[model samples]
Target: MTPVLVALEAFHVLRPLWLGALVPIAALWWMVRARRAHRAAPRDGLAPHLRDALTVGSDGQRRVMPIDMVCVALALLAFGASGPTWSRQPDPFVAQSAPLVAALKVTPSMTADDIAPSRLERGKQKIRDLLELRAGARTALIAYAGTAHVAVPMTEDPGVMLPYLAGLDPAVMPEEGDRPGLALDSAQALLSRETGPGAVLFVTDGLDPDDVPALSAANVIILSLLPEGQGDRGLEAVSDVPVIAVTADGADVAQIDRLLDAAQARALLDDDRQPWLDRGPWLALPAALLMLLWFRRGWTMRWVLMVAAFLLTQPASQARADGIADWFFTPDQRGRLAFDRGDFRVASEAFSDPLWRGYALYRDGQYADAAEVLSRVETAQAAFIQGMAYLRSRSYRDGVRAFETALLRDPDYPNAAENLETARAIVAYVEEAQEQSDTGEDRGIGADDVVFDNESGKGEETVISVPEDGADALLSADQWMTTVDTRTGDFLKSRFALEQNRPAPSAEADAPDGDEPREDSSQSQAPELAE
Candidate 1:
């Protein structure tokens, strides 16, 4: 549904009982206004010009009074208390930037240098840039010529997708054809595995008009690698799908980012699991702003202001109890003062509100206590803070859980999903390492027992050196991935051939005479990635 319709449908107050307060406030305001208007009515004994001169103020009817401001503010507070809401909150589990399956055409035409070094090369550059723009978002890659194959699965790591993206080429494909529809379908299939909202991006030199319906049906956007005037005929048919042409700068990537954000928002708005967003509190801001007018010379409540100032100026010491300040300031008020002064430990002890107390504890370097305390406050930011505390305490599993919960509450919570992924990865790595090292040999952090990991190039050179043909010089998986022991062209060729030669399921099940099922000829190589 359109946003306007959705808002109209969802518009309702959460605490409708609070709206009753507006009635009394409105009546009082009306009565006072009528009484003032009655008193302001001109006396029949006075002349018109003389009465005009005697009038002290300009047009009482049009003038706004302090009473009006108070009534408006009270009405706003009442509406706010009623908890007015119009839209559901987005699903917190969904990533802020939606998952994307990017399909790049690997046809010979992509190698054409009409635009630059090559259309294919430029497309790769665009994908690389887009990955940077969508750093924490899950992304997959596909290559299609005569057919389509998943080069990379959904992953947050741009590192994983880049190598496979650079490997795609026309020569690697077993067959040669412009089958964008196949590529689009493959991308859609990959995206279907994900539970949250996602989009499909087709990076191609040209598209077939026949494929327009498929693209239009899905959340798909096209990045045309062809020059401005070259691919108009095919692209003109793409009336529904957004077709973004190649740009000299980063404009194409920016446009793609905007499209992705918009698609994600659209999908989130339709999600039934999302909660209603509380819009009532937003009304308080205008009310508070309007009430600022009461601080004017005559409108000021001098005694009330003085009393407030006295309370705010009280000593911030958290240890003080039953003193004059204690009678004046609440524990939270004192805690706030202490917190503002950077006495976090004092603030942590003094704070009565669980949320504020947890924040103060976190600031005081009591992470475990902070995490435990923050659990009581069920909010996205609270959960996020708690997650950080867990990570800080080396509780990876707990950290992951906290981050996930935070995302479930608010998907747009900054860096929550990314941190959750990192925590999960760390936990997995630790578990795997422990399982592999189950020999139960004792290890220590001694000079000889210092195992190195995640080492950069120059740093690795300084620690240990191995001769080229040493017996123990077996290349690790990480070493092989970075250095590329196998040729990209050879790998793609074998995989493409395996998939192409695989028999169709229907052909295998139904023999010509319907006597028996046919056996597959290409049984040696399965059409699957060798993980």
Candidate 2:
């Protein structure tokens, strides 16, 4: 049932609050003016029949025109013209949050040719679909290679996990093995201990060594995504961790059942499942049609001056809607939604907008600029983003600081806390590595550190040298000969020269034929000129 409200939103139509006050004042002023005019005018004598007819009494009857009622009706019309409208909405319903976890395998086999584009990409697509389907669920992302890394901690936003998944390169960590046990342990770490209701989905090419016991021990619902056609037949499990085996192409019944069995995850086909009746078609279509008909009839205009008032009130309406919409929706999110609906260019523009310029800078490894832009975002989600930007920028100190700030604002903020710990660990690891490198240890930053370069065609490399204190001398010497672009490297060379107390070139040589020769030079013997 819809109840009518006076719709204070109409007041928004009045440009200025004081202008509304003028309504009563104008009426009073007009009344005073009429009284004065009546006092000044002289009354002329008239015949009884003539006076009776003029008095609205041609039949010898006198009556007063309901002027007060007429004035009231006019006032009501003016107010209605102020664009009064009723907002009809259905009864409020409670929304419940679902618990969800996405476990992605970062195994080397995932890069195999069995899947088109690769098993990892296919897994990411499936996970994206699952995330979209479970909109309001608390989600987490765990990436398992030789070891497991919590790509994203458990939280409400599943979208943030998208980039970490997308940017995954097998070459980043040595041709590392995929450890399912480590992945399960990480997944279990993310779940709430009190309630084992969380669902864990494993997206892999069924190549990881079986860790069915760990999976079962963690009470994780394992939904295994296998290569197309082939199932997880040989990939036997040590424990009965119900495996929901699905084709690499898409999610299937086999996959769903396995997932459900593993974690006791919710299944739609089950009789215990409660369905949400989609009344959208029933309500939305009829409401839209009714609105169209109502607008076409134009009867609402008689009592409400909506059309006329809307033109006068649009400025305020647009402002309010924009302010609120901008706060709740990020440009990237809006653009992605549009992209999902097939508006590619529009979505791309939104994602590439200046507002999110920091993210682009961060992606390019310019951490400082990223930190600046991300810092402006005050929400927990933004803080989490800023933390990532800082971490990628190699500003672990700043990244940790940002995560700490986020924790203060939202103690249980999922991604921030996990990354905060990671950032701290990274800082400590780097310090220890630097110490080791200083002591004559020829090892690289870490035993498994990997750096990949797709653009230069250098897949990945491990830097094993403890770069000499003056390593720049060698690179700069080569750069001086124009062997490489030394734009910033030149600046570093100049700075090093300054630190060494190198003297500036002689003024005479730097004069460029613009300065005068010294008179003292004439007293000295003339030097021989080159032939």
Candidate 3:
């Protein structure tokens, strides 16, 4: 079938109920109009004057053209509002087959003419055959002589490795002897970042003693290109790994096919496969044109203009709820607006984008949750935000690590160097505090040990003890106070005074004549916690 026909066949409505209801209602409306026109007809035997009087005010009968036009316009509008779609959308999390690494030996021995062509030429042909057979799998190419090097990184398209494979030679290597072990290590390094199951295909005539240990630990298929009678005894002795031997003269296609089948079996499974293109929104243009044509009849244009105005002014969430807006204005847009307004909790809940959600959680003082969300995102901003979250949660070691990662991504990242220094200072403070608490030393107040409640009329002081087990609890308590009231920090400082063997400051003493005390200008400002 043609492409247009295929798309038309796939066309479906998101809201079919609107069209279904309109059909029956239109039929009922036409029947009722027909009956009313029949009843209003003049009687055959009526007097001329009476008939003239009855028919004078009436236009002979209602025109079917106007009613038909109205019904057709309404039907078109209903179809347009139903949301027609024809193609599938691409999803980022779609599963894929495991990547394959081809470790080809490029030593001087491969230049031998055992077959009609050289062994190296025949080996390249076999690699091409394997790639064609496993079309969906991502492939990487590695060349090894004395040292191994990656010629092509892992990619879904196998054609990328073909050019590099054509020029591969032993002269490119710095060292001289066969070292297939290094090639296997290079393949492993390439696959380390991938979470899926993978296979290492070792294409060589023979293996060295050192290569056997690395081959034992890997899921490998050793392809031997020796002549019929000559068998590598070292490979035959190793029973743990699977080996596929193909003689130069009699290289059967079936043997290579079996090798590919084994590689695919060892690879990862895929899920929720979908087409890459989404052609649903293409229908909107034609639907809009049809609506414009209907507006040539007066008053319809005004209605359309009013609807456009309402949608433009309405909040995205309300527009979506009322079915006036589509996926174009999604929850992520709403979350960004909420974040700008300083509604962190609302922004966190509204955001579908993972990066924005993590940032919102950090702003809401949910540090542990923020760290968990930010860990999946690999960006300098995400690392910096994660470091701030860790620092606020009293995890100084983790904070230091996160800051170091941010600086590595961008050395001139704003505030990263300063935060790193502050994180180190906090680490030292935590260690010193732990030692002091352990030895029970300095019961007498020091400069850092106490915070005086100057607003308290009784001149009470609060001791700030950094207990090993109570760090998270103290942070939680501080967060709760900040959430309840902006000026609760001093109240908490005074409340801690009661725990330090000092007299509790009464509410009456803090406020004279039963009125609240004057707010301190310095206390109203946010404290610099990074230092």
Q: Which candidate has the highest TM-score of all? A: 1
Give the per-residue lDDT digits (tens) of candidate 2, residues 159-253. 66676667665654333776767666556555532132555667776644456555666555555555646766435543455555556445553
Which residue segments of model 1 deviate by more than 4 Å? 1-12, 16-29, 41-54, 86-96, 112-118, 226-231, 245-274, 300-531
lDDT per residue as tens, model 3, 368-401: 9988898888876678778878877777788888
* Candidate 1, lDDT over the whole model: 0.73
lDDT (C-alpha, whole model) for all candidates: 0.73, 0.49, 0.62
Total backbone collisions, model 1:
2
State every prediction's TM-score relative to the real structure: 0.60, 0.33, 0.34
What would the per-residue lDDT of candidate 1 be over residues 1-531, giving only the tens digit for each residue?
A: 334555676589989999999889989888877876777747799998898888875466567767788888889999999998876664222345678888898998889999898999999999999999887578888788887777776776789878778888888888899887777777776666555568888998887777778788888889988787664567788877788889999998998898776666566556665666788878988998986988887665455488778989999766656878697578997888787565789999889999889877876779999999999999987887787777667777788889889889988766666677877777766666545555544333322232422222122212223336766675555656897769776787787777677774121111123121111112111111111
Clashes by residue pair, model 3: none
RMSD of each: 12.5, 23.8, 23.7
Q: Ranking under lDDT, best-scoring first?
A: 1, 3, 2
Runs in model 2 deviating more than 4 A are 1-197, 200-288, 294-333, 336-369, 377-384, 403-425, 439-531
User: TM-score for model 2?
Assistant: 0.33
